[model samples]
Target: MVDSESVKSSYPKSITTSAQDDRGSMEKKQSVQQRVDSFESGEVETVIDKNIEKSALKKMDLVISPIIGFLYLMAFLDRSNIGNASVAGMSDSLKLYNERFNVAISIFYVLYILVETPSVILVKYVRPSRMLAFISLAWSIVVLSSGFVSSYGGLIITRLILGLLEGCLFPALSLYLTTVYSREEQCQRLSYLFCASGLAGAFGGLFAYALEQVHVGNMAGWQWIYIVEGLISFIGVPLSLFLLPDNIEKSWFLNPQERQVARLRNEANLRYLGQQKFDWQEVRKSFKDPKIYVSAVSQFCADMVLYGFSSFLPTIVKDLGFTGLQSNYMTIPVYVSGVLAFLVVAYASDRTKIRSPFLISASLVSAVGYVILIASNSNAAKFTACFIVAIGCYIGPGMNLGWLNNNVAGHYKRATAIGIQQTIANSSGIIAGQIYQSKSAPRYILGHSFTLGCVLVGLIGYIVLLFSLRYANNKRDERCARGMFDPTLTGDYADDFRYFL
Candidate 1:
């Protein structure tokens, strides 16, 4: 016993728990507390919860991304199926003489533009899930009714209604994503959802191919397209209503602990952004910001290419000497390629935390694609160029949306800004639909050239916006150094906030 006691007195135990570890933990808590104190002081109302676990992030993505993606897939299919219908003899059946087909396409955007802002603003008034479900049902009914349209005038009326409903989807989705995710997480999540457009294109091609083979009852192939797509959308309405959460705190799928984690994450974010309640002042502030208009113009330029290609790719391929079936088949490869490029660009943008470079690169790729389209006579070369155009046009706009969202803050202000952006950008649909006239078959040289010029203009705008963001950031840094910054500023107005260029 005396020997054992002597040995123990001579030995020292290893230190697994140290005072330093406790100090570190306490310091972290203190840091969070300090930030909370600042938030309470009303300097900014947003908070950041560094303690949010990886599992929580995974759960959020799982819950939100796929649902939005699926919804968008259906919406895009319903909207752009008219393109498939065009080559399926819709024009001849409806006696759509001259550019009346184009006029029908153009008319959709008129109502889309008019309703874009109100639809997005409505998301704030009602729950997002309910609003989305109601709109989806409404649009699906309109789409189903489109099959019954016997005349060009009827088609025009259906399209007008379709556009008005569809206008709610994109900008509302954009704003909804902002509510559940942090700024850095948005682009990738958006891309995850945005890949649906390409999927819709691919799926639409197959659907079109199958419908063209059917001749059931009085319905033609184009009518079948609308009927089938509408039915599919109708099936999704209930699912969306059930699955889409109003916000993180209200998510039915998440357990209480996960809900608490989500609430913490969102609360911290709200505090950091300095936003708690809706303010009409923020809405007024957005209109005065030059960045809003610049982003809108930039979107307009990119969409000129997007709507141009999306609205007419099937017809373009058909005009290149392929059968209608073959044209539909050809679209598969283009859209698949575009989806791959879109995912790659989105991932890279999120990883690098840069937006404009990808957008500019995409624009350049599309510009080159358009040049080849205009210059080439070989069908094979033109087909390859179509792939390039698909990649560029689809990918650029994906990032552009994230870029615009990144630059704005506050719930209502962000919604208003996105609404305005969509309103202006969708006008390109009208422009795109009209430009690719039937008279310009085989090689739509004017249409290709116009799209090319638009992409170039967008490229220049991206460059200018890049420099402008950098300039603003530099000025902010200077003001911070001089102690001239407003202490009570929050969100985009906060000195700590910088635009992602």
Candidate 2:
């Protein structure tokens, strides 16, 4: 919601006159028509009081957050459900030889990388309401199809299609939310959304366990898990359509003045990014931008390690001499601990408005945890170490993603960045799957080493981020002395435009 009564400042009147004269002296006659004056009240303020709004833009988040969350939770749950089923004897039941299950999980990332950018752009063009709803239904259908897959080829087909549908999800949700909230509010929204993944991880085990109790008519527990989760995803289609407001200003519930403020703010962002259409410029610019690349590559490595461990942990637990039921139950504490870490990181990032430090610390902690795992043989010790690894890795990508969002200039660039980030980062999925094949079960020597390497990449990426921040801050100082906009800046403060550490 926008605050209508906020005061706007542009230095003092004399300074504004001097700046105008200086601009004229530079032959840069940047004058606007009289119509521009309609929104340009000299007394307009920067602060938008949160108490003044009564729009669904205000109420919509509560409804949309859980809906989008539920959709993705199920998407990810079904994608990784094979993890649960692996221990439940999906391998034996289907006679999948030579760790094809790992390969199937890796294949999802291929489609994930391919479809992500286009899907997000589609969301921006077509509107999130329809875009997310359609994707929800599609992924639900794909997830449901997994239940009937009896052969490895069938499972692979389902995973590929599931990836294609699910790829659109997070980036679309991100672009949709950016239209409604300021950057400061974006992080809390992101955290709440990301916490759903933790919930999915925690609850997927429970869902599988509950379904195991059913064993209805010829279906296995894993099949029931996918079917139930898929059905739950379908429920979001209606919810998203009714909720998620289309184009913030069009919502009549917003006061005219509030609408004016929002429109101006959005226009400013669009100008900064320089497009009313899809901008391929961002792709080239992103390569030059240190934060974008660092965050993407580092996050890729993080996901590689995180997905590797999580996607295979249940099977690994079963191999570690735990029963299928015990393995399912054992995942609860690890995932719950991860949920705590996600919440903690979200709150801390929102409070401090910092990212790389948290990212770096978490990466180092994960490295230590993986190191501990390789050294220890005790089951309790191993569980604790893995729990630490989960906390370290699970909380990272959100902060990194949020960091990129805050720094990138517009909805399109931000959207494109997410696509690239998720795509590049997801390439690690292949490496992750190969690292933890069945041959390495019980004491997965190669898998632990791969995690250690990923943790190192994350740590190095953080270092690069620190240096990038230092360089950018110096450029800001130079801009301040020259009295020119840095061109890269947005939001209300210098620090606000910074990376999310």
Candidate 3:
């Protein structure tokens, strides 16, 4: 009787039953809207019936690219800034008068090579924000510590530490980003990140030029180069902690819907990678895959020329009769040339859905430039050659690495695959550094010759990968035609499973 009386009182005398039901429906709608909003906010990583906003995805890219770019810039700068130092007279001042400079620089690669493949396994387990941000700090310290070297031992030790710390970067980044963004989005994201390396190369030279003018207090120009670049790298560590999100679910900056949108995009990416299960056997299988070997071989070939030229380019410029400041300034144009090359290839590769041909074509073009650089005496010719060389050498990794990404199927495979690619590929740094000694400075014929040979070999290797991928695809197609396999299995297979070619 109290419920009836309360219901009668609560019911408005002016309202009928249908009108009351309308009020209930409106309240229900409001409750549903709240559920949608909660999902959009991504307070939880749960599934719901909601439409993903396309605009939010575009916005997410805007947020993530700069942070990823910073990582790449730092990667390029930390490893190759030593080149700027070489031009600034790192060898002469530190009295690494023997072939110790090459050996010292090469030592970084040993630690780099050892740490590279092993670090990938640890990548998924560690919080990349914590791991790589701390790594950035570690390497920044190593870079700064290089400035304190009064003896050869200190430089070698510092270089090794730099390698040890840097070992976590590119692979960790690839894993983290791919875990969130779709494959279609990956190339452009990767490109922006990689393009920053060219920017670093450009700025690294310019920075070295500015530092050369300030050779004062107790430091040589080269020593100051280390100190300054090291300081510059420190700026990134803090930004990474605050602005960076580890993956989609942890993306605090993104709303729930936006985060789901990110995850949804990568679903195709995941399936293409063969519904990747994170098993050690997959990693072992990745190692055994001949394609991995082929990719690594191609990577190694590319790096021999790339790292060789990078570590020694400044020294080479100095030998051509430019002062330290002049050599540093000269690198600006090369980097500018490389920046354009990276962007063009990146956009075009994604647009045309092509990868290998770009790398092969660029490698050969670069190989031609190396031939002229070694043979030329004209300064104008040499300067123009830098433009060509920059485009070729710098373009290879962005393209080739993207190629590796395109071919790799699962997360574990991609990790081990990229790990092997980097480890073997980076060994070229040792070879490149060793080839161009200061004594051979003005005309390091061997370095030039080796670079040309390696680039050509890389070009050939990419061609081989293309053929191999095509051959595999054909076999699969034939199997489908014979009803040995379901055509449905080939959708992500088509989109997600393209060979590195």
Number of the top lDDT candidate? 1
Show model 3 residue runs off by greater than 4 Å: 1-54, 86-93, 212-222, 273-277, 315-321, 486-500
Q: Tens digits of per-residue lDDT for model 2 on 242-344? A: 6656777665446776576566545434423336566666555654565677788888887876677675567646656788567767777777787688777
Candidate 1's clash total is: 10
| Distance from true location, Cα of 168 in model 3, Å | 1.8
lDDT tens digits by residue: candidate 3, 114-135: 8888787677677667777788
Candidate 2 lDDT trough over 10 residues, lowest sum: 7-16
Off by over 4 Å in 1: 1-52, 271-276, 319-321, 488-490
RMSD of each: 9.1, 5.4, 12.1
Q: For each candidate, give its TM-score against the true structure.
A: 0.87, 0.84, 0.82
Candidate 1 lDDT tens digits, 289-323? 88878878888988888788875576667767787
Q: Which window of 10 residues has the lowest lDDT sum in candidate 1? A: 4-13
lDDT of 3: 0.69
The positional error of residue 187 in candidate 2, measured at the CA in angstroms, is 2.6
Clash pairs for candidate 1: 45-271, 45-274, 46-270, 46-271, 46-272, 46-273, 46-274, 47-268, 47-271, 47-272
